[model samples]
Every structure is written in C-alpha cells, then in structure tokens.
Target chain A: MKGFKTQWSPEEADRWSKEDYLTFVISPLIYFLLALGAIWSLLLLWYGWLTLGICGLLLWLMIKIIDPKLKAISLDYEKKQKEFLEELEKIERWEN
Target chain B: MVSFAWLDWFWLVVFIVLMIVCGVLFYRLGKRSLADFFLAGRGLPWWLPAASVYATHSATDTPMWVSGVIYKYGLRGIWYTFFSAWCAISAFASTRIFRRSLAYTQAEWQTLRFSGLGAELLRGWIAGWQVFMNMFVLGWVGMAMGKLCHYLFNWPEWIGLMLFSSLCAIYVLAAGYWGVVMADFQQGVVAFSVIVIVSIWGIVAAGGPQQIMAKIHSLGESWRLNPLAFSGWTSGDFPLVWFLTMLVIAVIGGFGMGTSIDWYPEAQRIQSARTVRDASYSIWAGSALIVARNSLWAVAVLAFFSLYPRIQDTAQYEMAWYRLGFEFLPVGLVGFFFAAVVAIHISTISTHLNLGASYATRDLYQHYFRPQATDKELVWVGRVTTLILLLGSFLYGLMMKEITQWLIFALWIMTAGIWLPSILQVVWWRFNAWGYLASWMANLGLSWLVVWVLPEFRVIPSLPDYLQFWIMMVLGALIYLPITFLTRPEDMNRLVKYYVMSRPLGWWKPVREEAIKRGLIKPERDLIVGGQP
Candidate 1:
C-alpha cells in the first residue's frame, strides 16, 4: 500500500470512473428477463403452450427487489465516495 | 373524412425546417465557445432537456418492440417493460440531486467524491466502458433502422446506415451537446405530434378504441387483461414471481442509473439547467414521457396487428410500420412519418455519440493525459476524442459480439453486476463499501459462470428465467448482506463533510467550528471546486 504521504492519482480515479460507466451495474436483470420472456415465447410457439406468463411473474418478483436494492447501494456509494474524497482533500491540503 | 393532405406536407416541412434551424442555431452558438459547444454553457432550460430525454429515448426499436409483444402476447404486451416508465419518473424525481451536484457529466462525480487513484480508475473504466458500449451497442440501433428502411424503401442496409449515421454525426459532432439538445427538442415535438396524428388515424381506421378492444377480445382474455394484469403467482405459465423479477430487473438491473451510467443524460442536462427548478421541471417533464411512449408504440403495434394477418420475418414486422404510415397518411403526413422515424434514429444516435465521447475525453484523456489541461485544450481533445469514437463505433458496427443475445439477455445481467451493490449501499446505511464491492463481484462472477458453464441452461427441458432471476437476486443479496458488517465502516469525517456540502439528508454528526478553527478539519460550506475539507 502507498504511504500516508502519497498523492492521489487522477488517472486511477478516471480509470475507475470509466469502469463505473460501462459496468452495466443495473441492466443485466432486464436483459435476463427479456431472454426468459423470449425463450418462453419460443416455447409457446413450438409447443402451443403458454408459459412466459408464469415465469414472467416470478421473474418480476425477483428483479423488483433488486431495483430498490440498487438505489440503496448507489446512495451508499455516494456516501463512501464522499468520505473518501474529503479524506483525500485533507491529506493533500498544503498549509497555504 | 380526412382530406388534409397539406397537414402531412406541412408537418414534414416543419420538422425539416426545425431540424435545419437547429443545425443553423448550433452552428452559430457552436462557433462562440466550448461551453456552448459541449454543455450549452450550462445555460439550457427545462424544456430542451426534457425534450432530449423523450426524443433520444423514443427509438425505432421501441415501436417494433411494442408491436412485437402485442403480436405475440396480447394486452399483457404492455406490461413487458412498462415498469421502465416508473424509472423515467424516478429519474425526473431525482433530477434535483444531479443538478444540485453541478457536475457536467456523471463521471465528474468521481472527482467530487473520490480524489485519489481510486477515483481516477473508477472514472477511466466507467468512461471507457460507456464510450465502448455506446459506440458498439448503439450503432446497432442505427443499423436496425437501416435494415428497416431497406425493407420498406428497397435501399441497402449499408446505404441507409451510412446516410443516417452521417447526418446525425455531422451535426452532433459539429455542434456538440448544445446543438443536440436543441435538435432533440425539435425531434421530441415532431415525434410526439406525428405519433399522435398517426395514432388518431389508426384509431379511425380500426373503427375506434372500442372496436380495437372488441377485436382484442375476439383473440382471447389474455389479450385484454393478462399483459399488465398480474402481480404474483409463481410456477404457472404467467406466475407472479416472473412478473416480480421483470419489475426488479427493470429497476435494479435496467433502470437504477446503474450499468450504463454514461447513458444517463439526466444528470448532465440537469447540470446545464439554469436553476434547480428548471432542472427539476425538465426532469419531471421527461418523466411524464414514460406514461405513454412505450405503450403508444405497443398500442400502435397492436392496432397494426389487428389489421395484418401474419408477422413472419423481422423485415416484414418492421416494414409494416412504414407501410402503415405510407398507406394511411397523405403526402406531407407521409413526410412527417418518415422524418419522425429518422428523427428518432438521429436523436438516439447523436445522444449515444455525445455521451460516449464525453466520457472518453473527460474521464480518460483529460484525467490521464492532461490533468492540467486548459478548458480550450480539453475542448479540442474532446472533439478529437469524438472523432476517434466515431471510427471505433464504425468498427464495432462491422465486427462485434452477438449482441442479438446480449440485447435479449445480458443487458440486465450487466446492470446487476454494475449497479446493485452500489445502489444497495446508499439506502441500507449499514451496507459498507466492502460489502457493496463483494456484491458486485459476486453477482458478476456467478453470472459469468452461468454463461460459460451452462450453455445447456440456455435451452434445457426448461431452465426458467424467473428461476435464474430469483436465484441470482437471492444469492447475491444473501452473500453481500452478511459481508457488509464484516467490512470496515467508511471514514467518519469524510461522511460529515459530504452531508454538509451536498446537503444530502443523513445521520452523520455535524462538523464543529472548533475543528475547522483548529485546522483539524475542512468546512463543508466552502466546497465547489474542492471543499475546504
């Protein structure tokens, strides 16, 4: 680990920031549900049976909880990130 | 009954005139300074941002998507992703949060909160990923439009793709965010007015809403009540659990400002709004768009299905929309119809390009190559970065992964990995950073494993998607929650500073004056570029 005197690297911060943007933090479940619905749609076509409805409801129940959960985590991330920034500011501040 | 052929021509002229006017206006403003070019100099008001949100989001795929559902599932079709509308609403509701923060783009938030290498790394990765996704995934949207045009107008896909991309890129690249926002407003108006007119004409042709319902009833009960009707009931063909998962994925995985953070125009546009009220109002207006945008498409599609017998191929399915416009509407109206679709395509493409490139320049290039860059220099780099983005996106268009499947499945999976833990931490006060990280990585690793190890899962006797959704959420939460307490709490001083500066409501202890006087702490009141903290 770097010593307490180490200065912050904007480059590293930017790298993580880019990762944050591209990570798909929130949409995988949507695509998964789409896949499920699509698969069930195919099933209905092949066998003339209706199943996506049942599966869809269950999927909805499962994914619905995650949204609020995502919000909570995001809020927390903001909090932590805030704290981290503040701490850095303090350590980096010159007497001037 | 309808003999106003000039209305069509008039609307078409209006749209073209408006678009050209937008180009001209941007050309003028764009020449002034970088502020005008990139962020409209933070001078944009509520309406333009709201209009951009609506216009850029109302893509060509959406209409076909709505029709697709109705063609297959009936009224239940509306429920397919209708929950996303709530996401739009929530985004607006929280518009103040973003605007209040005063960051030009979401990536800038990384600097405000995390200053060191961690922040830089975060910024770089998120920006790179956003640009990459926009450059790659969004190109397909234009390509799809090309495919649609080819089906309808007998043009080649490449021909239409090049034409569409060139138009959008030319103006967007030339004008930057300033021009795009103005153009987006015009696009929104055109899209709304045209769709409404087309919808009225459709209703008339379908013998009105009552007849449309009657025809739907003729098909089956599911056609009427089943699409958006259920709440719960697992294991059945249309179980509540599956419905629940769909809703969860929409919010958690799809909507929660996760996954595609770069795709978030809300924060950026809000930053440019003249005031908090303007920002909030613009966001709220955008929220209202969710009410009918998707459903409108579904309604249009179902109405179309009511007329057509079979939707055999993708080409036929997409073409039928154009055919309806061409067949039912008169000359000017026909032109409006054409313009609206093209407008939607351009608006979306422009947004993706601008958003993606902003990340590349701001988060990656600026953060790394020139942290000391002047505003003038940064603007040039941003412009050059956009050019590089265009080339990369073009390449992505030519050769890439099978997003056809990702489009169907992986989008939300990526969201779960990218966003869930971070979102969870914000609300659950006890959720430590380590726990959030664990949740993110755990979800990602397991999901990745599923894709790699379980090809058969794709099509077994029935590996239920709901089952996967349910299991993943359950396991992800279960694993992450316990880990929260296991990790160290965030620094207390930093917490206090954030609450004070951002004025976010929280329970951390207030900063004392003695601490500031002693030079042991920084005051929250003095934090814009960087807090005294």
Candidate 2:
C-alpha cells in the first residue's frame, strides 16, 4: 500500500487472474492490429504482396518490443502485490 | 444555401436540451469547494476522465483537420495525429508522477519544485501563458464551428458561434469542471457515434472498402499508399525531412521534454483520476478512442476520394467532410451530424473555459489577490471567469478569417522551442525559473525573427515550417543552457522535496543526496530511474 502509488489495491491485484492480464493486453492489441490491418491492406492493394511481408516483419518487431514489456510490468505488479499481502499477514499474526 | 430537414432540427434541439440539463444537474456538485469545482474533488473513476480526454481533444476542427491532411497527403496524414498520441507513451511512463505531485495547476507545480522569486516568477509566467493558450485554442475551435455553421445552414458564422458557445458557457459557468466532464461523456459518445456512422455510410456509398481500394489503385500515384511519403527537402509543402524532424520533436517534446502537450487539459485529466493507476490507464483508454477516431476519419476520406476523383476546387477539398454529411446521411441523421459537430465544439470549449477559469481563479486570483478567500468566493470567481473566457474566445474567433494554417504552424513549429525547458524542469535540479523564462522568451523571439521577419524581409531564404521549427528548437536550446548555469539552482529544501515527492529521473544527484540526508528516503546504491516515485 505504501511503497508505490497504484490504483490497484493489494486486494484488487490479488483478485486479478490470467484472463484479466490477457484481456488487458489484447484489448489495445485488437485496436492496434485492426488499424495496422487496414493500413496493410491498402499497401498490399497499391504495391502488391511484397509490402505485406515487410509490414508484417515491422509489426512483429513492434510486438516483440512492446508485448514483453507489458507482460513484465503486469507480472511485476502482481509480484509486488503478493509481497505486500504477505507482509500484511505477518504483521496481523504478530499482533494476534 | 444549405437547408436542414425537420428531423435534423429535432435531433439538434434534443441534444442541446440534454446537455443543458446535464450541466444544471452537475451544478450542485461543483458548489462544494475549489477542489470539487475545478477537479471533481479528484475522485473521478478512470473512465470518466478517459472519455473526457478523448472528447476534449476531438474538437470541432479535429475531423476537418484530419480530412484536410488526408485530402492533401493521403492515408499517411494520420501521422499528424501521432504528434499528440505520443502522450499515451508519457501516460504509461509518467502519469503517476504527475498525479503524485498533487498540483492543481501545472503553474502551481512551481512552488512545489522551486523557491524564492524564481518560483513566483515561473508560476506567474506559466499561469499567464496557460490563460492565453487556452483562449487561443477556444478561439481556434470557435472559428471552426463558425465556419461549419456557415457551410451547413447558410447562417451567419457568428450566429453559429454564439449559439453553441453560449450553451457551453452557461453550463460551464453553472457547474465548473463537474459540468465539463459529465457533459463531455455524453458529447464524446455522440461525436464518436456520428463519426463511425458517417464513415460507414460513406464507405458503403463508395461501393465498400474493396471497391474503394480498387478506386485508389486506379489513380496510380506511387506515394499514395506509402506511409513514408513526403516531398523532398527543397520543393514540397511538407518535405520528408520535415516529418522525420517533427517526429523527433514530438517524441522529445512529449516523452522526453515532459510536456503533456495538450496544453493543460490533459494534465487536468490526469490529476482528476482517483488513483495513480487510474490516471495512467485513462491515457490508454483516451488514446485508443483517439486512434479509432482518426482511423474512422480516414475511412470517410477514402470514400470521399473514391466518389470525387478529379475535384480541383481548394475550398471544396476542405469542405469534403461537410459534403459527405449532406450527401450520405438520412434527413434525421444529418441533424445528428450537425449535432455531433456541435458536441465536438462544446466538448473542447467547455474544457478550455473551465481550465482557463481555474488558471485565472486559482493561480492568479487566489494566489495573488485573495489568498484567504473562502471556498464560496473562489467558486464564484471561477464561474465568472469561465464566462469571461467564453466571451474572450468568441470575440477572438470573430477576428480570425481562417486559423488552420496558423494552428499547424504554432503546434508544429512554434512549440518545438519550448519542449526542452518543459522537460528539463522536471528532470534536472539545476533548471531554475530564470532558465525557463530565458528559454521560452528566446524561443518566441528567435522563432519570430528567424521564421517570420527574416523570411519576409529576405534576410534569409524562406524555408519550410518544419525546417524553421528545427532551427528554432536548436537556438532555443542554445539560449537555455547558459541561462540555466548562469542562474542559481532552486533552494535545496525545495529541490529535495520535489525529488522525494515527484521522483523524476535525471540529473538529480544533489537533491537525492539531500533527501537521503534528511531521512526523507532510505539511501540506496541504485538510483531511482525513469521517474518512478
């Protein structure tokens, strides 16, 4: 609760599941992919299939750079929340 | 002369009534205190501010601007919108940093970061600049709405400007930011719905996406589909080098320089989020909407191109978007289109009026005139100032014939010179008020001298706006660095407080040491990096 300011309380983070993470990551990707797909189609229509391969490669590169960072941040956030909960449990046991 | 169907009139009147009712309802919420009035008491859920951000940015001119760019440059013109999209990156990285600072106005942020006459001067200067900038934006959008009205109904421009603006001013005056955000939610939905509906209609009318594609291919311009399409350095209106240069400036100006670059509206949105995570998430949500909005505009423009392949009239090109409304929409839906345009204008103007009033009331009035003023008095002042800003913007809007070119130049070129100072203020401890003052003044003076005066007089050969922008940025930096060193650094206590609170990453060694010495933060071997407070 104290280490960093986050909108997600420990309780909220603890409640988050793999589905939540996947949803969070995929939502933006849907928009991103749709936009890129529309643009790529235009490129392919005008220039031919070769431009598709090039754009696909660039998109893959972008996903490589961006996806891992998003996952890592999500994982790190959960890890911090778990650690924080453990600390809270220890304090509660001691007080009891 | 344009004529509206009865159904169009019905939708327009209904939407106007809906917004006024929402404003009157939120009026009670804003009556509580300064924080409540100006910030919704900083307890808003992430989505509200997110929607507001998207709505506020999608001004009356936004589609016209996008359509104009697409008209001129094809699909690649979307990059122009990318200029502000960089703020989403900033949101991911630094949204909480801004939230944790807890400054009401970015101007008020000075006192938290510095001390002495320097802080006072910096605050005053920022407050003044924010007011002017907000007015400028409101006027710019007002002018667009005026033009839109004239094109839509053959009505006088002022009639359209006054009608929508007065409606916006009344609600904002009654309810403050509470009215702005709540109304923005409805406005954003209407605006975005109209955009999507109109785009789809145009695409269908153009024989679908596949058909539209076939049409584009028939025209056969090599650069038409190329995202990297740009004119060469010497001859074109916007050259390849210019786009690349502007990209660098935008990235540096936003992510590197630390300016939200929405002027102050985006910062206010960030601050309004209830929690730090909410603040950051709001940007992503807002950004997604913005991206979708632009893409939708591209679809409509593509359809426009397909329908009218050889139009040569310049004004017609600019008005292509309005033409689509008249051409494609059903009678009732056409009214919805006009209503949506009004919604866009209201969304933008309301935020600016509310924000401009905050600067005048909180930063200028409360800080200087009545530090001991009660909440009731402050709220009263905020309402009056909102009305004043609305009037000022309307007056200024009437004075201008066209603001599109001036706007492009200001955002793209004039702002390039100020980004460094904005960035350095957060990241560097030694960046004092004098440095900020010098850099901004230098940016304005040198930019005017080099870009305008020199070129007009032929003292130097005229260059493209992008090239002029880069030159201004470099000279502005040249002036900024020496002034930073020449002036004394901000007070040690203030620097340490800023460091401990904001946790900005950069040349903050002295402040970090002081924070450690004062036992404000635990000493660590690894320095805090990337503004992680």
Candidate 3:
C-alpha cells in the first residue's frame, strides 16, 4: 500500500506502472493459493484455511492496487471506444 | 447398464426444455447484429461472460480427464488441470490489452496487429485453423458424451453424439452467442451445484473426510494426500521438473495471447465484457471458479479411490466421479445427475458452435468475401456457419475413434513450438508477422521430426513432453528469430496505432517513445493530476 499507486490519471494509468507489476506478481499467487486451499480445506486441513485467508488478503491487496488504475483506464478508454471501433471496421473491410 | 426411473426421464426432459427456452428467449437480441450474435453486443456486466467461461470449459469429458489424473497420481494430479491458471496474470495483463484492442476474435486481431500480405495470410490461416480446431474439439467432446451414454444406457455412441449436439444447436442456431451465454449461465449454475452435491455425496459415501484420510493412510497411500508429493526430480511420472514446467507455462504464459488454446473462446468473453475492468474480472473470476472446481473433483476422485483402492484399469478408474454419482446417488437424483451431465455437455457444444462460427463469419466470410455484408446479413451468416459447424462436428465425432491420437499430436505442436512466439507477438514490438508465420511452419515440421519420426527410426530417444517443450522452443526460435531480424518489423504506423490502443506490457519502449514523439500520447513527466499539470 505504501509504494503501490492507488490513484491514477487517465494518461498515467494508460502507461504500465508499479501497480500493474505488483498485480502481475500477486494475481498468480492468489490462484495457486486458492487452488491448493480449496482442496485441503475440503479435507478439513487446518493449513488450508490459513492458506485461503492469506489468499483473501492478497486478493484484496491486488484489487486495491490495480482497481483505481483500471477504473481510470476504463473511464478514459470508453470515451474513445466509438472512434476505435470505427477504425476496427475499416481494418476488417480492408479500407484502411 | 443403469436404468432410469420415470422421474429420471422427467428431470432430463424438463432440464432440456428449460435450457432451450432460456436460450430461445434471446433470439430477438441475437438477430440484431453480428456483435449481438457473437458477443451479446459487447455490453455484458462481467458475471454473464464469467459464467459462460466456466460453463464452456467444463465440457463432458472434463470430469473424466480430472478423474483419470486425480485417481492415478492423487493430489498431484490437480497440477495437470492447472493449465487454466494462465488467466491469473492474463486477467491483469493480456486480457486488459486485448479488451482495449476490441478485436472480435484472435484471428481478426492478427490483421489489426500487423499489416499487408503477411498479416492477411496470418489471419486467414488462423481463422481457417480455428474453424477446423473448433470442429475437431466439438467432435472430440461429443464423442466423449457418446461414450458415456453408451456406457450408461447401452445407446449407440452416434445417437448420444448426434442427439445432444443437435439439441444444443437448436438454441445456438436460434439465438447465437446470446443463447450460448444465457444458457451457459443456467447450465453453469446447474453443473456447479450438481458437482458440489455429487462430490459431497461421494465423500460422505466414503465415510466422510476423516475416514477417507484414515483409509488412505491404512492403505499405505498417505502420500496421496500430500499435494507436494513428487515421484522424483525428473524421472518419475509426477516429476518436480514437470510441475515446475507447468507452473512456468501456466503463470508466466499469461502475459502473451494465444499461449493457451483456451484463449480462443476466452477472447470472445474478453470482448463481451462492458469495460476493461469487467473483462479482467470476468476472466479472473471464471478461471478462479475453474481452479476451485478442479479441486472439488480431485477430492471426490480421492474419495472414490479410498473406497475402491485395488482398481487398476485406467478406463474403469477414469469413470470414478461419474460412478460416484450414478452408482451412489438415490434413484430420483440419478436422473438429476444425468440432466446435469446434459447441461455440461450442451454448454460446451453451444459455445463451440457459436465460437467456430464467429471465426467463420467474421474473419473469413465478411473480412475476405463480403466486406459489404450488412449487420442483418452477417447475423444470418453467423447462423448458417453455426449450423455448418454443428454438422461438421457430428461427422468428426463419428470418425474420431481412428484420428484422436493424431489430432492430439496436432494440438501439441500448435502449443509447444509457438508458445514463445505467441508471447513475443504481444510483448516484443519487433516480433513481425513473417516471424510468427515461420514459427508455425517450422514447428509443424520439427515437431514431427522430434516427436515421432526420429524416435521411430532410433535417431533419438522418446523425450518426455516437458523436455520436448523446451527443445521445440529453442528449435523454433532458431528459425523465427532469424526470420524476424531478416524481415523488417511491422509497419511503424501500424505498430504505433496498436501501441496507442493496447498499451501492451513489456519491451514496448520504442513504440511508446514514438507515440510520445508524435504527440499521440503525453510524456509521463507531463502527467496532469487533479486536472492541473
């Protein structure tokens, strides 16, 4: 939380930053933890619960770090999406 | 053969009707345009496409595949199904980039990413291959259902294949992806609930979790409970090296598009989401559900193993989870289980029917043949292509018995040789269309040589799959890297446009600098915060 950028301008969010890098690290760990945790917990293993709890914390942290950037990116991107879509059609039809 | 009571038949018929009706209700929405037909108008609120992703990947043969691995290797087998974890990083990485580009399919993305003849050729090749691959997958999955039905009711495999796929086609043909996604939601719910019920039932039938563990220990197989248990560093079937290789492939591969075959259908889901955030969450949550679902099936298979430890035959043990349901669930619930199976079957069928058609209609038909096709006409083309794919699947399903091994080999070649190139095409701006194309061609020939031809002639030993992956990757780079440097990079204008749109991660500094120089984007130091620069 200290180092991760929580707030972003549209242009700032458009560029990859430490928040994105942190997410790249955190997201996969959450998946691995969720997977093994689900299996072990179903068998009533204690460590399984702990693993899942950690996974939850990491998931929260990941969202906190990346969600703002994504929101900014999405908000700014949607404004231009119509223009982008038009360009896409031109490419599809070989008119470009 | 298992006998279904009248109640069983009732549940089956009711579920079929419900699924078809749910899908058909969206016919008007699907007929609105090509986007509506293929993508639900790209306005879905994350969860719909999330459910569709979960349901589509949970095909009829999924449990059988899961059961086979879990039964054979205990907890370690979950790693075998862990390839879907690519979505983990992809949710934040490639998924975001692809969502921004807004290509209808991966094939279409090619022409958007590259320019000129090479790009066109790549698009055509990928589109044709996707059409063929989807048909092949449909046949393979349909035949799996046919085999299960034959096993259950002594019905001919063809009847099982034709009956259910055609039934699924009714909704897909009527409503296209709207039908596919909506029905997938209902089917995802049913399939997931049934999976939980049957797995818990199987656990309780094995005298609950504690007793199952005790039995496993008493049977001197406690290692089965340890997820970290490995046979050896690299020699045994469940090797540490192989597990590490899988982790690299699954997790790191997420940064690239088309790294996993699952990315094709997922590309549709990615575009269907209303926003980039929605696209990211849908892929992440959907695959999160899959990871958890596989764990559920793993535990259930372990329960079956504890109950019947001496079973040695692969085919018999592969039916572990299904046997847990039909052999153990009560009479009326047996029908419910079968109905859920139908749900699982058709969810996959509908997705492929629409997915293959998306490639056929969007990339091939409209892009190449009928660029002037209207939205209404394109929607009709989507339907016609869906029908064609369905019919093609039935034929492939009927003949699948003799060609399964070869097609699987074909799939392996598709992944192994081009894995790095698929990633490079995203992260490295210098990875051009000719380089990508050359990788495919080189991999096709080299895979045959390394995997089969040389081994057959005693020129080399039969290498392990993980070893083959590394070898083919190095070998493929030998060809593609030279071709990449020899050929000029993709047109700067095209690269700049893609860079501005996608903002792709990794090694894109040159493109970013160009975009900045062109005043297309601002330098990071000039960023305005709170509307003040």
TM-scores, one per candidate? 0.73, 0.85, 0.98
Task: Arrange candidates, best DockQ first.
Answer: 3, 2, 1
After superposing candidate 3 on the true structure, give the runs of residues whose Cα lies further than 4 Å from its correct spot. Answer: B402-411, B529-533
User: What are the Cα lDDT values of the candidates?
Assistant: 0.56, 0.72, 0.92
Model 1 chain B: lowest-lDDT 10 consecutive positions = B502-511
Give the alpha carbon lDDT tens digit for every residue of A12-89 in model 2: 232223433333344334444444455555333544344445545544544443333333344434344334334322
Best by DockQ: 3
What tens-digit string does per-residue lDDT give for candidate 1 at B47-155?
8888887787677665655555555565565566454433432342234344444555666654443434544455566566567777765667666676666655677
Candidate 2 accuracy as lDDT: 0.72
Model 2, which residues run further than 4 Å from truth?
Answer: A1-96, B232-238, B256-260, B525-533
- Between prediction 1 and prediction 2, the one with superior DockQ is 2
Q: What is the lDDT of residue B430 in candidate 2?
A: 86
**Candidate 3 docking quality: incorrect, acceptable, medium or high:** medium
Question: Candidate 1 vs candidate 3: which has greater lDDT?
Answer: 3
What TM-score would candidate 3 get against the native? 0.98
Model 2 C-alpha lDDT per residue in residues B1-533, reported as the tens digit of each score? 45677988998899899987897798889999888899998788889999999999998788778877777787777777666655544564445456656777788777677777887787888888888878878887888888888877777988877788888888888888899999999998888888778877887888887887778888884465555676776567657787776556545454443354484787788778776667767776787678767867776786788788777655567677777877788777888888888888899999999999998988899887877688899999998888888888888888876556767766754376777678788667788988887887887788778878998999999876767776877888889889889888888876776665566656888887888789876665443432332
| Candidates by TM-score, descending order | 3, 2, 1
lDDT by residue (B411-441, candidate 3, tens digit) is 5777789889999999999999999999988
